[model samples]
Target: MNFAFTEEQQMFRDMFADFVAKEVEPLAEHISEHEEIPKALLKKAAMQGFLGALLPEEYGGAALDMVSYILLLEEVAKSDMSTAMVLHVHNDLVSRAILLCGSAEQKEQWLPAMAEGSVIGAWAFAEPDPAGLTNLQVMARAADDGYVLHGTKTWVSNAGIAGLMVVFAQAPEGPTALLVPADAAGLKLGQRDKTLGMRGVQIHPVYFNDVAVPADAVLGRPGDAQAVMAAVGDFSRLAMAAIALGGAEHALSLGVDFAKERKQFGVEIARKGAIQAYIADSAVEVETLRSQVYRCASLADQGLLDGLSASIAKLWANRVSYQVANRMIQTHGGYGYILDYAIGRVFRDCRTVEGIEGSNRTQQAAIARSVLAAHGFVM
Candidate 1:
């Protein structure tokens, strides 16, 4: 695979970076303090075709290659992770699912609206169980014309603002996905959670009491939940890895800049060995993570992304995110603990990388299972 980005990809990266610098970075603090991203910013991103970054042109999408999409997310994340995550769910998790698994009629119904940013998409997959995709508690009861969904989804990102949601529930055939309009009758949003990081995200518990939908609302075939999830999860994880890479790079830059400017004992801290070591370690991880993230992105573009590779990239990126952020805080000393500093916010936001998509343990389990299976250790 070519490590270097194509000319078009670089141009896209430049555009993304410039947009984020002018629009996103200035608002990062405000969004965190207010716990909400302004609708105007999202509209601007949609205008840039970021909301439809990976969709086909026929549906009003940008039709960008996966590498370019990764670059877009990476640039946005460098300025604000909340905005990046909002786009991630909209593009990678929900709209991409429809593009990949929805029937042509379904795509025709939703894709244009989604691309135009008239409707924002959300994914509702978790339940009381933290990892609810595999251990689903929601049930989809068969009805005369369609299905009636019952139960609640927890920690649903973009719940408050999503116009559409792809809700996962168990059907008679097996686990199934149903696209439900957010304003459907009997659907309710519980109070939003006050999270430690990514506070700008509007995560809530979504309750469904016999929420009914037509049979055509089903995404992909019945009993094909595993396949659909595998496809979506790989893409989402790769996107998360890109976000992590950009965030880590920003944190490392913060530390390096601080070290050069801060003075202790009549000299700059950058001259200290400990500070030098901290920056050195973080720089190495950031570079290594960059390679992994881009390679996986390229693989995705070539339609060769595998579960194991995606999991590995996500797990490693999660580690790098936390480590780099923590090191930045240490480099900041007492100033890091102060909320007035951007490092504190970055540290809090970076912590969510491990918990989202899948936890570190979740990634480890998947990796171990793959390795053991390859070694003929069958269950």
Candidate 2:
């Protein structure tokens, strides 16, 4: 398959890189320490259409193809994983769902504001049970006028700041997807989660206490949560894999620069065989991951992306990122443990993506299932 980026894609990558280098990289340390992305930086990103990278042009979006969209996320990740995740949740999980499943009226009502970034989107799916859709604790009871939602959604990304949320809950008919405004009465956001990394993501537990939404608030059809979630999950895994790839590349660069400057004995550490091997191994893995990420994006564009491919890419990316980050830390020696070093942050951020869309165990199970099915082994 052709992996070469088109001229347009290259141009988009350059634009994204320029923006991240100027506005994101400089603030990466500040964001991690403050546990917040500056509102001004987010607004500037919105103005550049990065927030609307996947929506159609009619809705004021860039309408980027999947590869170009991947490029955007990858570039942002090289600077700040937190900002990349914000864009990922907005475009991949929330806006894309609205564009794909919402009725024309729903689209008209939400898409433009979402594209313009006046309305940011968040996903509310994970619950305490962690069994996924089949065992969602959140319930949407049908009422004469509409539905009243009751339950708590945990680990909601972009929680407090999101203008809109796509929540999944159990209905009488089974699992269902609904659109709820963040300001709806009885919808409360808990204190922000103090995560191990990716501090700027703004995750929180969302409480829905007798929250009411119109009958039309259902996304797509009732009892269609499984299908909607599966689609969104596949794309999110791929997007996350791209993020891991970018983070790995950035870590490698930092390690290489340090090794070249760090003096050992009478010469630089770059002259050492061990340092050379670390750099070479990391470079190889980074290139391999780049291929996997772009191939999956191309598959998505061709409507040929499958659960197996996405799972593999995500699992591999997570593994490679963590490994590369660890090796780079070793290369940095004591400096790697210091907060002043960028590798420390990169290492922390790499750990967080492993559990974002689907945990490493989740991906492993998915890969096993696919393999067994292919081998004609029925569970």
Can you write out model 1's per-residue Cα lDDT over 1-379, one digit (the tens) per residue?
4678899999999999999999999999999999999999999988999888889999999999999999999999998888999999999999999999899999999998999898999899888875555567898999999899999999899998899999999888888989999999999999999889888899999999999988999999876787778768898998999999888988988888889999999899999999999999999999989998999999988899998999999999999999999999999999989999899888888998998988899999999999999999975
Q: How close to the true structure is residue 28 of candidate 2, measured as C-alpha lDDT?
A: 94
- For all candidates in order, the CA lDDT equals 0.91, 0.91
Mind giving the per-residue lDDT tens digits that candidate 2 earns over 1-379? 5768999999999999999999999999999999989999999999999888899999889989999999999999998899999999999999999988899999999999988888999999989777768888899999987789999999999996799999999988889999999999999998889998899889999999999989899998898898788767788899999999889998999999999999978799999999999999999999999998999999999988899999999999999999999999999999999998999999999888897877789899999999999999977
lDDT of 1 at 336: 89
Query: Candidate 1, 330: how far from true, in Å?
Result: 0.4
The superposed Cα distance between candidate 1 and the true structure at residue 252, in angstroms, equals: 0.7
Which portions of model 1 miss their true places by more than 4 Å? 130-135
RMSD of model 1 against the true structure:
1.1
